[model samples]
Target: MTLATAAHAPEGGTTAPAVRIRDLTVVYKTPAGELPAVSEIDMDLPAGTITGLVGESGSGKSTLALSLLNAVQPPGRISSGTVEIDGLGDVVPLQGDKLRRVRGGQIGYVFQAAQNSLNPLKTVGKQLLDLGRSHDVDDLRALVSEAKELLGRMGLDGARVLDSYQHELSGGMRQRVGIMLALVLNAHVVVLDEPTTALDMITQANILEIIRNIHAERGLTTLVITHDIGVVAEVADQLAVMYGGRIVERGPVRSVLGEPRHPYTQGLIRAIPRLTGDIDQARALPGRPPTLGTIPERGCVFRDRCELRMSVCDTVEPVLERHADQLVACHAVAGQEPDGGAPTDDGQEQT
Candidate 1:
């Protein structure tokens, strides 16, 4: 399937976005001083649409997700940025009870590795009760009913799954449980991190379908974080590419995938092995991604591995600029084609 034709919400159409992230920068207090794990990032999760944030490990995808709920732990803080939710204003300054209420109340999060995130010691039902109690749900029966309904909707016997411990359920079942917990609180905005990490190809496809169905059915705004580009192509209407903590590209999934401008984005797409394409055409990127400490203090963070790197890339960092239908951050691309030239057979943009 083409990236643009995923079963997702209509493109460029959203009713008062559910979440708006602006100038978001999360930093970790390391011996080398405050190193950024997520740099000046800006994104929007349109009301009732799915926006996928794709990148390799250590690309700050998870850090950006945590900033949504302002849940970045100590030593790591949302140094600068504003995360504005629909009902809640800028969440950057919210604290204590107010912040707690927003998390899981208005926004639900399905963390990476749903199975590991669950409590092995407690049965699913017991944990669900704990969640309700923490939120001060007055009617325990009503809450349980909602949980059961959600689980049943996902095609599982709610009662049995709830009675089972974390170890008792399979990986896919645990993932569905995670989704149930996130929605059981009636959250309108959901953040799913690596929703299909360890699952086989078949299970991954199943989970993606469930996500699409539930998102459309509930009219929810969703942000899906994954390292896999295929996952984004499967369910996201809009796509954002992150590298070295910065968002280098973003736009409608179809436009961005059809003609990627950024070298990093092109390289990533080129690396994916296609069933019909020549196997030898698929190739890996030249160098490894930069680590936190190794990230350049100045200049482009991706220049070290970029084949199209220029002298300016070593001195000035590229800023996000509109290129045709997508936004790209690359000196090479910006200098070459104003329209972000189409991709060639090799996947690199035709100069």
Candidate 2:
């Protein structure tokens, strides 16, 4: 899909947006001081498409996802920015009962490691009922019926699965249960964090297919967070690459994957193992991702690992600038022409 098609609206005409995030920063308190986990970030999840946030473990993908529900916990807080849902204005200031209602009512979250997120003490049905009660669903029988239907759609025996405990289900089954719970409330916006983390390749493929099918069937706005670029490439219409708390690159999934502009994105794509490429061509990124305390206070966050590091990178951080269809934050690519030629000092495109 083109950038305009993927971002502004899906195949159909313009629709109300599902979520808009702007200047969002989340920070955790440390002995040293407050450190950012997510920096000034801006993102849009169009009403009926999936937007993927790809990054390493410490890249704040989860934090950004949590901010959507205003669920950031203690020590860590949404220090700044706005999370505006279509129905709910800015969720940054929502608190107490209001915040609780918004979460799972309008927005559903399938957390990372679905197996662990479940309460082992309670059966799935009991937990589902508790969720209904918490949300003050008047027709609980109807709620239960809806849950059963959703589970059935996911290829599970709804009655038996609901009666069984978490341990009774396989990894893939638990993941489906999680998805069912998230959607049973009839939420319009959904967030799935590492939805297929520990599954086998076959199971991962199955889960991804289910996600894509359910998302389209429901016409839901979805945000999928994953470390695997392949996952995003498979299921996401729009892709955003995050590193060191900032989005380094974003664009239509096909455009970004076909021709990655940011150095970090290029390295990530190069690192992926391919089915037909020469084995030696697959290389891993050098060095480890930065910890919260170790992130640079200024300048480019990826410069330490970037091959095209320049003097300008050491002092000035490159803001996300449009380069054709992609928005890239890298000094090396900042002034490049749409056709990919860098401008020379004399204002001519370098050959």
Candidate 3:
């Protein structure tokens, strides 16, 4: 289905959002001081749909996703914010057994690297059974049946896959099995971190198809975190654009991709290579993303590289405000477009 069509909210037309996050902030405590990874973000993940969170490295996309699982480790901590799951109360403050119960049971997570998640020395069956045992499924036959069933959903031979070790399977197969593991606990929400990274084009397509099918058939809410715009274009119903530890733009995938309001969002869309368009016309966003420690204390984070920047951008930070259909955080886009001529050959507008 098309993005616009798939993104139309309402499975039964009465279900509340699956997840709600408000004023969320994650900080990493360092010797120098505190550095914010995710800063005061507000977002809603609708039930039974895929939401794509897109940004470059260090943009806090993965950190934000992990926070949902209370998986942020070490120096990284959820300093502030409330993450409310549908039936469960605020998950932000959950600790020990409560937190452990929620993770891998209520909300499943597929990490970026499948091999790293698996034990090299153990057979996949042992690991799968271990997870089952944690959740109190002691029957070996039942656990094996469940493992085979989940693998079958992904079109894999469950028995064969269970007998093999991590090194025995291909990268794509391992990734699919990772996803299956997340579902083994019958979690309501699934979070996939760069699920398609490091896969061949054909493999990527197959994985995406599996994700889409699971979402449709199981009615599970999904959050896909990735830097690939192409993956979002193919799988996401809603899209959120992040920059410098904040969500700069958010709306339906069709609306955001087709008529992006924020300049950063626009640049990301333009950077995608189109088969029918002029190859050389594609341009990368100038300037590197800001480091977490180096993020400016005030003003718009993207002001330095933004072609539409005005004097106001130097002094005033932009809050996410409603534009036409999407919410965008940009002082320049909040009012008038900074008067400059159309884009030039060099990818910058003429003053």
TM-score of each: 0.91, 0.93, 0.91
TM-score of 1: 0.91
Q: Write the per-residue lDDT of candidate 2 for residues 125-151, one digit (tens) a residue.
A: 999999999999999999888988988
Off by over 4 Å in 1: 1-17, 339-351
Report the lDDT tens digits of candidate 3 across residue range 118-146.
98999999999888888777686876888
Superpose all Cα atoms of candidate 2 onto the true structure and report the RMSD in Å to 1 decimal. 4.5
Candidate 1 per-residue lDDT over residues 148-249, each given as its tens digit: 999998889999998999998999989999999999998888999999998889889988999998887788889999999999999988899999999999
Output the worst ten-in-a-row residue range by lDDT, candidate 3: 342-351
Off by over 4 Å in 2: 1-3, 6-17, 338-351
Q: What lDDT does candidate 1 reach at residue 344?
A: 35
**Best-fitting candidate, measured by TM-score?**
2
Relative to the true structure, candidate 2 reaches a TM of 0.93
